[model samples]
Target chain A: MFEWNAYLIIIAAVAGLFFATAVAALVWAVKNGQFSNLEQGARSIFDAEEPEGIQQDFFPGEADEQRAKLEKERRPS
Target chain B: MSPLLSFFSSIDPKARPGIPVKVQLSEIDESMRTPSILFLSAAVCWLVIGSFFALVASIKLHSPDFLANVEWLTFGRARSAHLNAMAFGWANNAIFAVSLWIMARLCKTAVRHGGLLIIAGIFWNIGVTIGVIGILTGGLTSVEWLEMPPQVAPILAFSYILIGVWGVIAFRFRQLGHVYVSQWYILAALFWFPWLYIIAQTMIFIEPARGTVQAITNWWFAHNVLGLWFTPVGLGAIYYFLPKVLGRPIYSYYLSVLGFWSLALFYNWAGVHHLIGGPIPVWLISAGIVASVMMVIPVIVTAINHHFTAVGNARATWASPTLRFIVFGAMSYTLASLFGSGMALRDVNVVTHFTQFTVGHAHHGVYAFFTMVMYGSIYFMMPRMLNREWPSAALIKTHFWCCAIGIGIMLVGLHVGGWIQGMMMNELTPDGNPKYTFLEVVHALVPWLFSRSVSGVLLTIGHIAFFVHFFWMLAGPKISRYREGPTLLLDSIRGEGKAG
Candidate 1:
């Protein structure tokens, strides 16, 4: 019966350790500026911007002439 | 056009040409082609195999004498095999393929160690095979989720370590300055799963905790397998594909952060609810119930984030196969989770515990929510990986409807029948005697079990269609001039800026 108490203590200690680790992680994240730029983080998925002046390949079935025409219409005079 | 009309039209983003994200995504998909294909194909094979086992098990429930003589096909071994196959073989493998691809793309890094990933995947499947076979051959451990014998656990763990480390390595070499919320969830899951698995194995099997503590450890591990392991990966995929398919970001970054952290903190503790009526202390059960209720914060926050993001985009969501299935899964996640919290209450748990209601809830979480989202992710992924449009929209529609309807019937039949069974089991006569015999209650469940078998057949059809269509796309030629863009359910939605 006393062994039950020992097992309980061990479980409690493990739970405490998990709680402390989580708090530590939260603190480290805050300290390291992980939460500073929320909007930028949201936008980060689209960070793969191709360089200007590179001729991008047209999607399948899209004519090159049509793409060039669209590009010309977008360019300033 | 009139000035007023032009003003309103200019404010609508959907009226504009779609963003040029697909080209960039294709590059990432190209880099991950080999490993992602291997994982996906293996996962589909397991899905088919698991569905077979599931059907057999469901049949035996209604007709016990059908295959009673076959040692390997007995209820105990077959059911355990089905659970492990679906959980580890199918779910883990699909997560490896989809989540790793998402991690690589979100980090802006081409997968560096593709060969290592394939090798790890092969070994992981091998381990699961050995484990399943061991269970059939009289080596069953009787542990709920850890039914895989001890001899195979080490190999499984080692293979998982190899696969999991690759995600961390990819993040270490990431090119982005800002880590997306999806990355945090995926990365955390990759770390948490092995820790939970190892600790549970040590306590339950190796050191062998005394008496009811073993039951405590078992429930803790089993529930965490669903909560920590499967839930995070499923949510990560939802966070990624939801935004990408809608061509927008998640509605509120603050809400996402709250949802992620609250889930991480509360879910691990809620596992104790499975032991609510057991021999454990009352305070422990109360803690589990509290944490289970606290889960509402994350569930509601995530539901709102996903819901608001899809608002006004119903047309596109309905038109795209990926978004359609994912939205179904997202809604299921919210409903199933809230229902789960309610089930954890002592009053409700009294009737639901040790009944088929719990089984219905488990399927709701694992199948309707997690597996549906995975199917959606695969639909989006296969096109990008193969650089071709799906050969048949009819097949995709067939797969979706079959699974949706099948799981729907199963959940309804199980819950309604289980409730009757539970209530009857709890009833007593005025003279302090039982109202119904145990066998009588068992006899009542036969009809519901038969309905479950019918649902199983529908799901099997869905699985076959999915696998056939997937392989057809793989072996077919790339997209040509005639079959140009990504396939959409609606013709008008084609060539729009939707990610496959």
Candidate 2:
């Protein structure tokens, strides 16, 4: 016997343990309100400086007027 | 219509569907700079080294005697060295820089002990350097993903834990509120990777599992390293950057949650598919196939989430280099995962198993999907971290086009070539003899392998441009204009502005 059966048993036990741990994580995530406030969670990465609406990235050759216009639009009035 | 200097059509910058936040990115960016610079600089050096090894290995496949005079550059050793260098060297270090920075930003917690991370990164790089040299000098192991000698394992594992803990610490002290989707992906990957690595090392190397257990364990570990470790880190970066660049939230938060959990649950089980037609139990193989097919749910879910978010912003995605790279990578993720699911079927596996088809698919996932995503992250992260824009937009464009075209050529050549080779090998004479002699098949594959090598050269050129551009920003003059302007992709290539 190559102890194949024993290996299977160990595999089964480990599988059960992982499943249980995954379930626990899911439960904790749900209970901790991790699943709530769905849209707000999506927006949480933004900030006042690099605020959400304005596109922060662009090429350097913007006409001076266009650049000034964007800077003005981005400022909090 | 009177034209008084275009009085009526005022510039109304189109606002993307975006979200607002409370904290300053500058504070978080400052916290990330110390550790991230060390990780990223080291990663760039490794990328160059890995690219060299990759070119050498690829060349040797078609022309075996090309480097025959040098023993270390033999195909077997060179190929393994390339994989180890890229995997442990470039990819892991990039993840440490990009994913960890994203975690800290989303966590809203400064990395408390930044010095610890620098130390861990040093040791990790040192360990990889040693392992790579050892592989070249004939200490290579039989294990697939764990090819690094037994001595290198402990150093990598310990250092990785120290580095991974910084992420966990940030999560622990996170501002108590909504856990962003990016944070979920980052956190899960951090926890999962170390566990998978440690278990794999113990089972296959430390104690040495017996009989068929070793083979099974090897595939289990190797496949999951891609599925659970690299895939999550790459996906997490995509989720974070897409929104930041496009100024929009993910299309559906609930669907993101679904995508994440399903990926975590099914991916680990999918590893056994690598052992199809092996001596493993039929039931085990079936389990793997089922899990791999089930992966389509999350892949499609993620694709929809990202595509819709970036749908109307096509022009922006093209103009902004960061968005350009990220979107390409995201699209590749969908293609690679679908191709993977298809290959997992019994009939498909029978054809693709040991052929160049598998090799092509590996690059599709690892390079096209993961590596490109990392490139996008570097382009985004470096400007913010250095407080300066990229030095040359032309070079960035060069890097992107070369890599995109290179990998595309590679995929077509390898897959198409492999399919023909596999069919010829499988052709049986009436007496069940192989129809094509092995030498004939080898002769047939020369052109495809040469195409792969050609792609490697293009990729190496792209890599060099990226490497030079990275340092140029860090070391170049500290002019005020370059400091303020973000390098973009719109300017005419010849007469580019001061950012040139």
Candidate 3:
């Protein structure tokens, strides 16, 4: 007789659907270019403070030397 | 991986954009310095405490009477205490530190209200302290993941909101740029965790959902805490640190989008796999099983993205202590999650359910995957925040090896042993009786259980070494300049990173 609870399942489905719908509505409302310029967000975490080519956490006496060396190596001879 | 792709590895990164001068990195670091240190200190302290509790509980498995006389040290109380202490005390505190720091950095904003954030952190730790104490003193609610007494709920809830609100604030005021994938994860996690926490507290205890609904809700909450909560933050850290440390971008932007949304969609429904054999609806269990299997998509996407990104950067990954731990954690994430999907299969779950196998899986995911990522983030963040290299490279190496080996041993002992235990327990005698007695099962698990204790001791030793190194650096006076190079794992690999 006590095999399973159908009511509980229905409640769960309803709650999930409600949240999904709410999220969809929120996404529709915010047309603020949230997903635009995809690459910019990818690279935005980089700053001039520690530029991409220069590994900030690297070893060596001077960070500038590491960058200079890398630039020189990658330069087209 | 790189030797085959050696030609592509040296492709000119000169095509990449010069760093924009939008945000001051140092200013961001300065703003978060005090709070990050505070949270990390608390996390390490809890790591030690949790280690103690874990050792006690593991010992009880092999030698129950070892602490039989001590009331607070009984198996139930000790296990519960360890879970709460590690989950709330250690893991959450580490998340607060690294996740917030990463969010602020990605948002390109200095945290505006540092004082309030610190206060919220204090309250969060205080709440966890009280809750752990409650569990030890017999106030456990006996729910699987929500074992802390009912009274500790509000304190945790309030503080969690206060801390989480800062991530939202940072995102709200984020610089006008493309929002990075890490931001998506941190933001989702910040919101998803609190909703799960509050709903769990209410449904499971406060206003009891009758019968198996409570049990279902409990598993749903418990499972998703790892799925929705820890997994997102861990993956986000990998996304952030892997690229940053390797000096590259992720392999594909589309893959990131695929990984994030698929995880969100599938992981929510996957929690019911925890209740497979229990008296839940079969349809519900089936839905959960499908979702768990579907998790393979995001897992594969993440693995490909990270693996390609790290291909040419193997030397760089090795040179930096941060990436060493991170690479290990990222690999663990892929392994454990895939194993988890398999474990959720009905056939597998039948054998593994209520066995030590499930316990082994928990550590595989939480310790091997999540905790190690947090440790890497700390390695990355601490030096930047303090503006000084770690005090001792030797100690850092010690920490890494100890933790790596310890968890490795743990994964093997528990999984292999648990599988054998499950098989033996499920075996039936020829005359239609259970073959293995409960006592026989116990006797069989002794060696594996002893290995777990041994692993715990190793982990505790690592924690002490880490504790000493971290506090030493935190307490030491800041060096005025970088006259001496940042500490390196090996000066032998001269041209790779240690150019000087």
Candidate 4:
């Protein structure tokens, strides 16, 4: 029975260590300004830009036609 | 402007007006192409192999005499093979592919050692192969979830180290300033798995813990395999894909933080529930019960976050193969977790313990929740990796319906039948005799076992369809070319917007 209780102490120590590590990570994240811009964090994956000199249109297929229509709509005449 | 500079600019709050969305998502595709395909292909092969083993095991449960003469085909060996194949062979491989790609993309860094990843993946599969064969050949350890022979463990561990460290290295060189919630999950899972595996192996196999303590260690390791490893990776994929597909942010960032931290803290302690009604002390069981119940906070928080994000985009979600599987999985995660908490209660545990109810609950978590989410991630990742759309939307639809129906029938049959079996076992006649004989209980499960076999057959059909469809997409010259855009469920909806 004491052996089992000894195992419990190991469990407690591991649990305590895990809790400390988690708290430290959380503090580090907070201090590093990781949580400051939640909105920007969400949009970060979409930050990849279309390669330069390629069709600037984000939509696939009919890119040239779409560019022409945009240019015509923006003309001063 | 260069994509790298634009990436940094986009993260800066003040420079938003000048920031251009010029980063070709294809760059991510190019970087991850070779490794992702290699891992996914291996995972699909294992899915088919594992499904066959599962059908064999399910059949033996109801019909004991079938294939009994073959030494290698015994129920014990076959079942162990099936479990290891699915867990290590299919699930782990899929996780490596999907999570690594997600990590690279989110970090804005190309996977540096593509050739090394492929080599590690090949070794991982080889290790699983040798381990399964060892179990069949009478080298089995008989430990639940660790049945893979001792000889194979080192190889698996070494290969896993290679792959796991790759993810951290990618993160170390990440271009992004802010780490997303999904990255935190993936990173934690990568780190946690090796620690859990090594410690469990040391205590149970290496040092040999004292009698019941071996059982304690077993439960701890088994439960953490599901909770710490599979659960985190699945949730991380959900956190990434759901928002990406929906073109929106999660409902509440604060809730996500709470969900991640609470799960990390509570789940590790909850595995002792498996020891209930056994020789372990009452305090351990009580602690497990409390922690299991505490799981409600994270489960509900994740459920709400996923629900509110997808609720408004019902049409788009249904129309995308990726979102449909993911949403199904996200919902199953909520249901399975709630049921698991309920099962930990003594009153419920009394009836559910040592019954098919536990088996059904296991599938509900591992298959319906974890495997389905992995399937969704595969659908999302493959197209990007291969630069080609799925060959046939019909095959995708067929795969989904078959698995959904198969697991549904299996769960209902097992739970209802098992509950009755448990109740019957607990019944006592006058003078303290079991109301039913042992054979009678076994006899009663026959029909439920048969239903499980049928469900296995259906699942097998789904696996074959998925494998063939994937192969056709990969090898067929006509469909292998890079498609200009993604394949959506409905042609009418294609090119409409980025809603997919």
Candidate 5:
């Protein structure tokens, strides 16, 4: 049988309950949109691309000229 | 010229075949390049210097008389320099470069005025170089990681502020929907580091606190710097790469948040666990022990998420060097954190404290978890940044195996030696006379010392190979056209199957 000091046991129980609540709250946050689009947001502070992913911004910006340069770089005559 | 020649000459087809080749050249923000390059070059220099110190320290451990009389190359100084270089120069700079790239690419914006970042890199390197020299010249402050002389500390402080300001500005301009898990960690780490750094510097050095208060603050700062600053960036990179390489969404967003918040709340308090059983306050020790145990929640959640995400795609381990190193590092993070929590228990700490077990444990965290992930970042980066394939795949493999085995042997040896040392230290005669002397205990661990030397050599070999391969790739070579070179191991393997 566990030797339980009443006060100490009560403290331990309270602490455990607090931690469990905290854990539950964190899980909820992750399920919501907290973890999504992390990298995009970190860098988006610099440019005003369409709020969508990098793929979406390609058509509107300097994508055309960059595409030409890439095409030129790849052609091996 | 043959039509093939003409076709080759006109080879600017503008896109990677099959993959989206229409990458905007402007997307490769020129502003970010110089800062990244500066950080990388400085990191390489620090790696070399750190490795050299490691060689000396390992040799000293094996052969105490090897440099018995040399004041500069003593175990104390050499070990400090080695750790400083690895932390400040290698790991910190690598994180900075990757952070810059990730910020640029994710935001789809060039760094606004990257001049400050470059200056930060220069000042950071200068501070570290001076700090390392100061350590060798007997000017070390004798702090564990902050052994830098007073002269260099302020310089480093200034550099951190400058570098951190750029990140703050970048965070402000962040685009919506791009605010992913990795970005949160990066932003938090950037803010957390300077606050932690400045407060500790002020409390510990600028206005010296009372005797044990400094030690308390030191523990708080060191633990948080590792947990809050370095761990965040490494985890951020893993978050990015895991999804990118697996081509899958993370297993659960819920788990990611659970992992992050739990870490933020618990890890800062757990550093004092290192001082358990020492003369620290009883309440502080209790708090640290509780926090350490609570860390398991985050570790377990993160591990499950990573493992589930990585399931079925285990083949990527062999195919993509980046994934292999990063995923392995992610696994090590679990291992290190778990080991740390266990060691925090009073029973375990009794056996592991003041022994090689602690050393082994720290390496598992620093090298296996952090450095391995950095390697993955670099592997992913070099090809994209340089617009070329790695010069030789064989060298990459060699570097991987060497680092892996070196750390493995080092940890195993340390564990055994530490256990023996702990047990022997525990043994005392009935009359209060010790059964075995300290020297005797030292003699008992000689074999482990030799093993450590062997492991150090293996690690050195890996570092040297990595350094060479990186330089070679940076120095581009002329090659024939029409050879649509595959970038990743997975791609090459798939290509081989097609050819067959």
Candidate 6:
């Protein structure tokens, strides 16, 4: 029978393990350049230019271009 | 519109396929700036209301006679007013202003016809003003947090729908790409708040749920409002601010994804933890406790990611007002979440519940963690909106110190006071009756109360200073200034600030 005390301890241990793995993965991501540009990521959608060497593959068709034109016309002069 | 087309458009454009991305003011393309200005003004008024109510409530704790026992300004009404004004009025309005900016930037679209949003802002202000008046007039519904009376509640809810419709429309017209973390939080908060608010109001106010169910439901509603609504917005801010201030990318996208999913799944059941040891069923409480402790996983993950993101960039703590508030908020989040989980333990709650400890916990989350993060967001945002930097770094420094010290002192006083109160309550007399006199507990808290008031004064001063700076910034005096390099002391000269 798993007593409440034992269950709690086990759960806590599992939580600790999960936390460790998460931290390790985070550090790995940081090294891999996940957080290199904060403002750029948030603003990328609005700006037309791309970061050099980074290729964006979204919006591959004419409708996308049409929407872009509509958005452009709405911009403040 | 075809169903498929409608669905595609309905999906937030921020989720559309990739485009070239860069961080610049130009990226924040919006059709109208008026809604943002209106929301900002609302935020300032709400800040005053929230802090003033907080002072009233805090003062009442020590001397119930401080205000001559005014019926309308009773502790019950004042406390609820303080929290609701802060959460709904101040925090939500600020979120509206910032989210509009972020959504437009992320979606790669102008806030298509945001003129409607300005009207929505006007409606929101009216609703909040009426609601606060209702609370002060003893029109409270007797529920914690959701205390607005029926007459005021409908107005508030209606206003929310108008604003929410804008958010939905904005999401639908967004440029396509993978949904970003901030988008997830904003949209989820928008959706979850109405669902929770409306359902709870209907069930509690209209239908009148059965005994104990109401209590359970009240706790459920209160906790979720914090978790589902405020927490998402706060985290969304952290997601934005950490990278922006530090000039880095989030450390781990995969980890963030996991953190989000785990949080959504684990956070809902956490409301039950507040009911621990209440008349609620043991199983329900146990489930809540489990979820509370399990929250450690998400909190730790967020903490680690945020902390490391600013490791080498810690110098920015002094340079950037936004970074200072945000970093402080991020640290507080770790402590509050951990503290919450600890309090979920039966041993801790048995003593700490129904004491100043609960008050401490509430402020720790709402003010120290949630409000601080929002402050950071506002600081980061205002310059962009006003097209001018803050006029006085001195005022910002003063505000930061006052708030930081004020909250620190208040939390410490409350925690110690509550522990003593809890211990006294647990004592038993030889006759098997309660041994501790209620007066004894009350008397013990006197010093703590005085300390709390002192801290309240500090926080109030900070808020007033912030208001003055904000007002001056808005008026556009065109003050000639240069950055005073980061110095250990205000008077001392140091090197240049990083961003400056």
TM agreement with the true structure for every prediction: 0.88, 0.90, 0.89, 0.88, 0.81, 0.80
Write model 1 residue lDDT over B418-445, tens digit each, in one string: 8888988988999989899999999998
For each candidate, give the interface RMSD after superposing the true interface residues on Cα.
8.3, 6.6, 6.3, 8.2, 13.7, 18.1
lDDT (10s digit) by residue, model 2, range B219-314: 877888898888988898998888887666778878888998898777878888998999888998999999999999999999999889888666
User: Residues B1-500, candidate 5, lDDT per residue (tens digit)?
Assistant: 79877644332323125433223323444456678778876777677778889889978876889887999989999998898888888988988888767665654444655776787888898898898899899998866778878678789888988887666665555444446667667866886777677767776788765556567677777877778888888888887767665445677756775677777656767778878888767887899899899999988998898888787655444456777788889999999989989999999999899998898888888888988998887877665555456767688888889999998999899888989988888888999887889999989988998898999989999988988887776676744111233233333343334323
Query: For model 3, what is the alpha-carbon lDDT of residue B321?
Result: 77
Residue lDDT tens for model 4, B3-120: 9898555444345555332324557667778888888899999999999889889999998888889999798999999999999999999999989988987876666547888899
Report how far off residue B266 is in candidate 4 (Å).
1.7
CAPRI quality band, candidate 6: incorrect
Q: Which residue ranges in model 6 land beyond 4 Å of their true spot?
A: A1-77, B1-32, B429-431, B477-500
For model 6, residues B1-500, the per-residue Cα lDDT tens digits are 89888655544444445533323344343243667878877887899878898889888888888785688788888888887788789988987887767666555556644666788788888888788888888888878877877676677788788777666666656654455667667776777777677767765787656556666667767898888888888888788667654444677655665666577666776887877778757887898899899999988988888877777554444456777888899899999999999999999999998888888888899889988888777776665555445666688888899999999999999989888888888889898888879998889888998899999999999999988887877786553222221111111111112112
User: Highest TM-score among the candidates is held by which one?
Assistant: 2
Query: TM-score of each model's B chain?
Result: 0.92, 0.92, 0.92, 0.92, 0.90, 0.89
Which ten contiguous residues of candidate 6 chain B have the minimum total lDDT?
A: B487-496
Which portions of model 2 miss their true places by more than 4 Å? Answer: A59-77, B1-23, B479-484, B487-500
Give all candidates' CA lDDT scores: 0.81, 0.81, 0.81, 0.81, 0.72, 0.71
TM-score of 5: 0.81
- Candidate achieving higher lDDT, 2 or 5: 2
- Cα shift from native, residue A33, model 5 (Å): 6.0
Off by over 4 Å in 3: A1-37, A58-77, B1-22, B484-500
Q: What is candidate 1's lDDT per residue for A26-56, written digit by digit as tens?
A: 7877887989989767766643232112222
